[model samples]
Target: MLFTSSSSEKEILSIISKQLLLGSTDARHPFRFVNLCTLDGNQPDSRYVVLREFKEDLALFFYTDSRSEKVAQINKNPNAALLFYHPIERCQVKIGGKAQIITNTELIKEHWNNVQTEAKKGYQSVLAPKTAVSQPEEGWVQELKYQSKNFSIIKVRAKQIECLQLDDEGHLRIGFNKKQEVWQSTWLVP
Candidate 1:
């Protein structure tokens, strides 16, 4: 496969219309991530969080404490980069966007009430992610129809997407930009 002609960005983006998190190699198919914001300035200051849902091209879902450091960072810098990888697909997707915090009590309750016990456990981590190295601990958890008002959801509005593929075709880097309310993309050799 070889080509050297300019094409409409939409033509190339058609292959990636589906919202998915794929691997860049063969050993991490399920390892997924979402873009995060931080005030630390280091690229790694960003965390790899499980993406809970993708709501069309307008929004993406993630859960967190309204009091966490990240919440503060988003309040300051809303721009971020979300990365998702799946080893089995030899694919990697990077998203650049602005993060919007959702604070509607009704919406938060709806999402929280549906959360299973295992997932609900995350609420405790907001306090201390690695407090006990090797000892018993004390903490509070939610199991009933209750959630902290601080429980928040972050929605990412994607403005650009970079999808990379590696294989027999060597490596390809494609970028998509939102233009005039439509997506336009371009291919680059990497």
Candidate 2:
């Protein structure tokens, strides 16, 4: 287990922050790809999204096409959740937060500039995600585009974070809730 039963809350929080920061830049990190959950009316919608950025303030950011169904869902309801797991470490981190589509043109442009040439195709698709297509290729852009108007950033401001460490001895579960800009930690039943 990454954390033991006697591990302090600060230690766990530090580990989580470091792992998330590393995930944003390390392609091979297990946390690089996370399951993002959003609400589609009464149903839950989920998909894998790359961890684009992890801010010092504990905000998580992901890139997506502005026209995608997830974008619509987020617009209707900002509440969302993210799950990250490290199989080798037997650690799972769950985050509950509010999501907001970043609309500032300058911020979007800055992030867009950082996207690799080949990776930009995801946002440049002629057809939006989840659109019905006869062939898989029909959803892709015929010509490579330098800039994509559909590129957008989804930022999740975490309200609560929970970490679970699995071990033969005993599983350790801890939770951190943000209240008035302060994070209060508590031990939870595993």
Candidate 3:
């Protein structure tokens, strides 16, 4: 087996840290695109979002339009999940946490300035996301202005982490929970 039955908590966390680093720095990393899941009434809403930032404590950062439907869902319920997978590595990470939205702040301007011109256009949409447009051209903004007001930052502080690694020999699944600034990890069945 690739992993021993006695895998340490530190080792699991280290693996997670490496994956998070790859997600943020490597463009081709599979973890770069994560499925962000949020509650919409009693159902679930999920969408792919690029990973903007990662913190060791399992906090994640992503950008989206302030007027997006996901933002409204998050407002109603802060609980959320970020699911990531890397096919080549045969690894999957599920992070559960509370999402906090940041807008109208200096950080928003900083993030807006950092986004590429092409991507910044997403926030400049004439109408909010999920709005019906009569024509294709009517949906987008032709202006080059990078409006910070419409840029939103989502911060997710992870309360639980589930990581699964599949290999030819065996599959390993681990879970981590944070309490009082300490992390407790345990092995889970695949």
Candidate topping lDDT: 2
Better of 1 and 2 by TM-score: 2
TM-score of each candidate? 0.75, 0.97, 0.93
Please provide, for model 3 over 101-181, each residue's C-alpha lDDT reduced to its tens digit, 9 standing for 90 to 100: 985588888877889988888888778888887777788654556667788999999999888889767788988998998
Q: Give me the runs in candidate 3 sitting further than 4 Å from their true place.
A: 1-6
At residue 120, candidate 3 shows an lDDT of: 83
Q: Write the residue-wise lDDT of candidate 2 on 1-190 in tens digits.
A: 6688778898888889889999999999999999999999989999999999999789999999999989999999999999999999999999999999999999999999999988887877777788899988788754465675989999999999999999988888999999999999999999
Q: Which residue pairs overlap in candidate 2's backbone?
A: none
Cα deviation of 20, candidate 3, in Å: 0.9
Off by over 4 Å in 2: none
Instruction: Rank all candidate structures by their TM-score, best first, as comma-separated numbers.
Output: 2, 3, 1
How many clashes show up per model? 10, 0, 0
lDDT of each: 0.63, 0.92, 0.84
List of clashing residue pairs for candidate 1: 9-185, 22-86, 23-86, 23-87, 23-91, 25-87, 28-87, 29-87, 35-81, 35-82
Worst 10 residues of 1 by lDDT: 20-29
